[model samples]
Target chain A: MLAKRIIPCLDVDKGRVVKGKKFQDIQDIADPVELALRYNHEGADELVFYDITASHEERKTFLDIVEKVAATINIPFTVGGGIRSVEDIYQALQSGADKVSINSAAITNPTLIETAASKFGSQCIVLSIDAKEINTGKWNVFQNGGRIDTGLDAIEWALEGERLGAGELVINSIDVDGVKKGYNLQLTKTIANAVYIPIVASGGAGIMEDFYQVLHSDIADAALAASVFHYNTISIPALKNYLVEKSVPVRSVPSCQLY
Target chain B: MIAIVDYGAGNIKSLQIALTTLSIESTLTRDETVIRDSNAIILPGVGAFQDAMHQLRSDNLDKILQEQAAAGKPILGICLGMQLFYETSNEGGLSTGLGLIKGKIERINANVKVPHMGWNTLQIRRNKHITTNIPDQTYVYFVHSYYATDIDNDDLIATSQHGENIPALVQHNNIIGMQFHPEKSGDVGMQLIKNFWEMVS
Candidate 1:
């Protein structure tokens, strides 16, 4: 059986990790490679290095970080944020990234998805969307870091993304982002059902049960969290143990002999 | 030294880095002499079958690989490279493979998903050189749409369930194939790689 994935997303700015708080043991919290290896050691199924760098000049530095992380870490990871073109996708994958996630670029040109998926196989092209609930049951796609509403229906965009050759979709809820309440299960499930590809639920993961709730319920194939993992609030090994206890299949940590 | 066959298929950087971390020396080369002289070969790829076979044939790596396999030299294929070892692939029409393994590559007909991506536990069939030190139900990363079917039962070493018994690992004497990326599969995958290195050593 396929194991549910637990992913830890790191926000990088000017080649340094941002908001990497509560790690007294780690030598440098801003170092993305060190932080990534820490997550890998704790048995994270995958890692996402979201390049939140504001300047184009510093983007090269972020790619350097991606290379260092790829050379150091053994687990699979995705490089997301600021991926605007086919060249960017090529650079990220050439730097040893297993997958590249595109957001605002896919919305502006949607053809970028088709081109990237064709140039590089669809397995490496991930369509990441930032969605916000506008009405009782209607969700709209947001771009530019959740500030600009594209007026595109979230479900329709997901279907379109899959049709456009995106191998996977990351549905990040802007409303619940940083709220730490829980994942936008309703939105994630809707997208998962609408598309045949895998769906990764992002934003608002507060507790371990939140992961179990989203993954065990079969709403999301993977649950991605940043702060909860960065702050050591929920260690991955312990979380996997909890998930196993709850009958949710997760990859066991090598050090943890519970299996 | 190991020669990682480079036929312009896909990224093999991570595989090189993984070997470096293991203190194993490897060179990504398409040179016939280099590959023939190397102790072992690692065929790494991530793409469609027909295109990959086309590249291998164009580069004349198909002949070298078959010759090396006949010479009884160890060669390990990963993902699409594994699929290329079979006789034929139904990926993009009926394309011929290297015929190292008696099997055919077909699209996964499981109800779960198409690509069969992400981590999946391996159900070890029997103890082998590669399965040493690896526990049963160990998880490995996989990212492919087609799988090897109609393989010899004696060559099968392990399997993973993705709504069906997907052939995760196989070995026919010196030639080994893994449908998953061992370099990206964390500890368990590293163990499998180490075992391969041990076999080569």
Candidate 2:
């Protein structure tokens, strides 16, 4: 059986890890590479680098950082944000990223999904959707960092992504993002039941119990958290141990061993 | 020196980085002479079987790899490269593979997810030198939709349970195949690579 993945997302802006209200406050928590190394040693199943910076020069630095991180860590790494074309995807993969996540760009050009998946096997393309609940039992898809509402139904959009050849779907809940309440289980389960591809539930992971709830509920293949992990509020090794106690089948390093 | 046979696979950079971290010198090349003269050859790939085979044949790497294998050179195939060692694959059509091992590649049909991505424990089938250092049931990363099936049981060395018993490791004399990416599988994977390195040395 494949173990449930625990991912630490690094939201990078202007070559720095940023968070807080409106994502304006640039927190000097730690260097992205150093934080990545810590997660690698601490047993993070994967690392996600979301380049919030849109400038071409910053993108180059992001790819350079990607090369450094890939050279240092021995786990799967995913690069996303500002990836609009197949060329960007190729650049990221060539820079040592194991997978590339497509968001707003995927909506502007649905053909990008097919082009990328066909060019580089579906295993390398991840379709990340930012969804916000508008009415009872309804959610709308958002793009451009959740600033534009596309009016596409979340479930329908997920199916479309699968049809377009996305290997996996990262359904991020804009309603619950940065709130640290819990994952939007209803939205995640709806999409998971709709698509056969693996679904990674992102946003609103406050405690280990939040991870246990979503993973144990069978609504998500993986749980992604940023602030909790970045701010040192939760430790990955400890969280894995907690999940093990709950019988959640998460990979863990031995007590005294980490390489 | 180890020559990582490059056929435009996605993992070339990370694979080379993994070897460097282990202090093992290696080169990514398509030159027939380099691959033919290396201490060991690694066929690394990540793509559709037909496309990868097409690339290999177009570049004449298929002939070179077969020649090296015939000469008793240790050859290790990773992921899609592993699938290429079989007789045929059912991906994107019934494409033929390099007939180095007697097997057929088929889609994983055990009612589980198609890709079977993430970490899983290895079920060691044979007590081989390549399985040394790494303890039984240690978790390793995997990412693929198709798997090797109908292989000679004698060639099978290890299996990992994902929807079904997917072949994790196989060895037939000088040829070896690993379904998972040892480069991205962290410490346990590094140990497996080190074991393969020892075999060639």
Candidate 3:
């Protein structure tokens, strides 16, 4: 059976990881390539690069970062944020990313998902949804970095994205994003149960038990975290060790040496 | 020089980079002359089986591959490229493959998730050049919806469980196939690539 994946998401801006406050504020933690290499050595199953840059030139810089990271590490990584078109997807993959993730662009132009999937295979396209609860339990899709609610039901959009040829789904809850409490089990389970593809539970991952709950709950094939992993509050190897003790299958190199 | 087939399929970059990391010289070529002239060939792909076969056939690269394999040239196919070596595949319809190895690609049983996307431990069945020095149960990354089954036990090198015993690695004389992406599968993957490169070098 496939081992559950533990992903460390790096929110990058101008080739450096943006740290501090759930991906807010300008704080450079380390070079993206260096950070990715560290994670690779520490036994991270995969990595995700979220490009938070603004201009066209920055996209080039981000692609360069993706190339450097991809070359340095052997594990697969996904590049997300600001990917608007098929050309963007092409450039990202050409620069060495295993998969390109699209968020707001998929909402604005759903055909982007179809065209990308058809052109590059569905495995290369990942539909990333930023969901926030508007009513008691119903979640609405958010755009432009979780500011604009698109009024589309989260679950409905996920199914549509799958129909349009999305191979995997990444559900990130905006309400508990950086709270460091736990994953939104209700929101994640609802989407995971509905979709056949692998679902990555992002946001609100704090303790090792948090990952345990989501990964074993059949809600997430992978659990993604930024702050906990980025700041070393939870080392990937230690977390994997804990999961191993808890009987959760994780990809861990028993004798791995980390810097 | 090793000819890394450029069939307009995916994952050519990472394979090229993996070779570069090993200090091995390689050329990404679609030209038959280049492929015929090279000492070794690496067929890297990631996508639907039917579309990949169509691209190979349209460019006549399929015939070139057959000739090279027949001429005793060492060949290594990764991911979908490996699936294309079988007799046939059920993906996107019943598409024919290179038929170099005796097997058929079928959708992984519904017992597990589709695209079985993640890392899994390799269960080494035979000690071969590819599995040399690679520890038993060492995890390797995999991402695919279909797998090659009904393979002869003699050609099978290793198997990984994903609701079933998936053909992780296989070899028959000069031709080889790896179901997982060795290029993206960390240190163990790099070692396997180096071992393959050494076999021909």
How do all models score by TM-score? 0.96, 0.98, 0.96
lDDT of 2 by residue, B42-82 (tens): 99989899989999999998888888898999999999999
lDDT of candidate 3 at residue B135, scale 0 to 100: 77
User: Model 3: DockQ against the native?
Assistant: 0.61
* Higher-ranked by DockQ: 1 or 3: 3
Clashes of each: 0, 0, 0
DockQ score of each predicted structure, in the order shown: 0.57, 0.72, 0.61
Cα lDDT tens digits for candidate 2, A1-259: 6899999999887677776644566575668899999999999999999897767888888988899999999999999988999999999999999999999888889999999999998899999999999998799999765788999999999999999999999999999988889999999999999999999999999988899989996699999999899888999988999999999998876454433
Residue A54 local lDDT, model 2? 65
Q: State each model's CA lDDT, in order.
A: 0.89, 0.90, 0.89
True contacts kept of 3: 0.72
Docking class of 3: medium
- DockQ of candidate 1 against the true complex: 0.57
lDDT of 1: 0.89
Residue-wise lDDT of candidate 1 within A146-233, one digit each (tens)? 7789999999999999999999999999888877899998989988888888999999999988998899977999999998888789
What does the lDDT read for residue A164 in candidate 3?
A: 96
Once fitted onto the true fold, the runs of candidate 1 whose alpha carbons sit more than 4 angstroms away are A20-29, A256-259
